[model samples]
Target: MSRRSSKIEFVGSQGVPLVARLDLPEGTPWAYAVFAPCFTCGKDWLAAARICRGLAERGIAVLSVDFTGIGESGGDFADSTFSSDVDDLVRAADHLRENFAAPSLLIGHSLGGAAVLAAAHRIPETAAVATIGAPAEPEHVVHTFGGRREEIERNGEAEVSLGGRVLHIRREFLDDISAQPQAERIRRLRHALLVLHSPSDETVGVENAQRILDAAGHPKSFVAIDGADHLLTDRADARYVATLLAAWAGRYARGSVPAGPA
Candidate 1:
């Protein structure tokens, strides 16, 4: 299979120019998908790049976005919130709908999983949603702030370091996450849902998988990303996730074989 990727930019919900990597197969794709990366991670993060490109090679075009203030996108981290993230996801889906085909599948990693669950309602064309090592609620991300959680709470905003990058975290972000009704969103999510979590994932924890599954309605499924890390840093593990996702999403696509390995 001939697969390629190109950088694309679009206006985000906040009107900032957000960057994305659109991975495409050689010819017209039967289906398309949008990917939301882990919090603070860029589009080229190992897991994001591999999984999107892997999907492209399998005949499914994938648009992997670097949300506001992250990666090549333009915005201030301290000013971004959970609600903005969800809006950005909807904007990404809008881009796909206007330029190519509406994405039939939506996938997320880490806190982004929560974003997709909440944004699905805004994108009516989305037929399926999948998340990798996602938290059941947006508020769960507060734990990652560690001692800085107090600093942000007391001062309203604080600069924090993540993955070797220093960024600002504002109190509004905390408050916004707390206000999100993620569980209710999952319960009402009309699309088929797939939850992929690593039983050994030290970051998000496996219990979250159960929490999401229990809240979601029919056509929900859970798959253990056995022996995988939170980021799916291992090539083998990411490949497995991509393979499974392409196959699962194929059932929703109008026409096309399940995208298997090239």
Candidate 2:
């Protein structure tokens, strides 16, 4: 079935308007999901757009959001922290609950993936959680800061190049990531988990995925994306992830009887 896409605006953690895209199926959807984009990436990122489209085509309405200070969202990237990102996810889920349906599934890409893992407990309605190229801990993203860490530490903030765009990096952002209790959250997560990572991904190593799986409880499964990159830049790879995720989530998110992996 074909899908419809619409632009949406919702208040974020900091009470600023955050822009998003809602992809809906042609008919009533079996479930609703929230998709969080990669670090420093927006809702319209190629992978996010394609995955939302793919899920919508399979009868799931997907809402992909731009976190505060990124994409069309209103806020300063330098003022946001990893904890705020998790709060933003909660706000996004609240928006969904008020307007349409509560999100039964939460999907995140890269750092966004880690955010979902941390935020899942706050959204009691979430039945399934999925991560693509997510790190085991929030601090894993510090590697991207590279040489700028010293500069940010010494000067409070620094403008660094990320994905060809310059963004402000703050010492508070680094401290927040380092202080997150992500592992503790994962150990107690009540929702089912699906971890998708590419074995060859050069960005967030595959070992991160292993650590996440190890920390999560039962009803969790892992899928290696094989030849995909960290971003799942290839349209085919992104679509494959969406398709598999939709199917896997069906067992939990669709209000059907839960079934263990074969």
Candidate 3:
């Protein structure tokens, strides 16, 4: 494994500051990628860091950030919505553009996958979009608001525990997600896309991958990681994702990064 240099930045967005990790190769400028983890996930999560390390090993820079309420970022998760999540992505991208080269790839996992799809057009330099165990619709996460819909509306917020972690869900967040037509946006996505899913994925059904694939236009590809779970926890599974991303990205990514300061 190659050594990676990492830094933390505090970015302002939606009236709050977000914490993000910028991971890059030492003393080298490489193609850059903006990677977003799943709901309630942080940049240091097992999958996110692994992907960053993998990309960096190939001379690619990766910016992995925690959203408003997740990880070390500020703001309340309950106060955040799908739209707000996209805002965070834009902020991260802009930050990288100023200090590093424009991003050549936009990678998201699960819900983050959906986000990258929505934000692709805004980040024109992106060569490709990739998703892992991503859902087909933005509203698909609405199920998380179950039983608390009334409370969130009546009290303005509801506490829900997911993945063994407790998070507050605000009505605004629910409204934003419900208003998004993710499937339609995905169909119109103009970038080359690689949809990766596992048949054994229990979190988001494998059918979601089909929905995304079917809706997408040409220059699209789908790969099934036969036995891997949604998170791609196994070393082999994560490595496979890295290999595939490197190969696909090479075809469309922009020029190599400028060499780091001598």
- On TM-score, the candidate that comes out on top is 2
| Runs off by more than 4 Å, candidate 3 | 153-155, 256-262
Q: For each candidate, how many residue pairs have backbone atoms clashing (under 3 Å)?
A: 0, 0, 1
lDDT at residue 122 of model 2 (Cα atoms): 91
User: Model 3: clashing residue pairs?
Assistant: 78-168
Global lDDT scores for all candidate models: 0.88, 0.91, 0.82
Clashing residue pairs in candidate 2 are: none
Model 3: worst 10 consecutive residues (lDDT sum): 253-262
- Residue-level lDDT tens digits of model 1 in 67-140: 88898999887778989988988999898889887888899999888888999999988889999999998899
**Candidates 1 and 3, the one with greater lDDT:** 1
Model 3 TM-score?
0.92
Please give, for residues 150-236, the per-residue lDDT of candidate 3 as tens digits: 888798887887878878887787778778878788878888899999999988899999999999998999999889988878878
Best model per lDDT: 2
- What order do you get sorting by lDDT, best first? 2, 1, 3
CA deviation > 4 Å runs, candidate 2: 256-262
lDDT of 2 at 185: 95
Instruction: Name the weakest run of 10 consecutive residues (lDDT summed) in model 2.
Output: 253-262
**How close is every model to the real structure, measured as TM-score?**
0.96, 0.96, 0.92
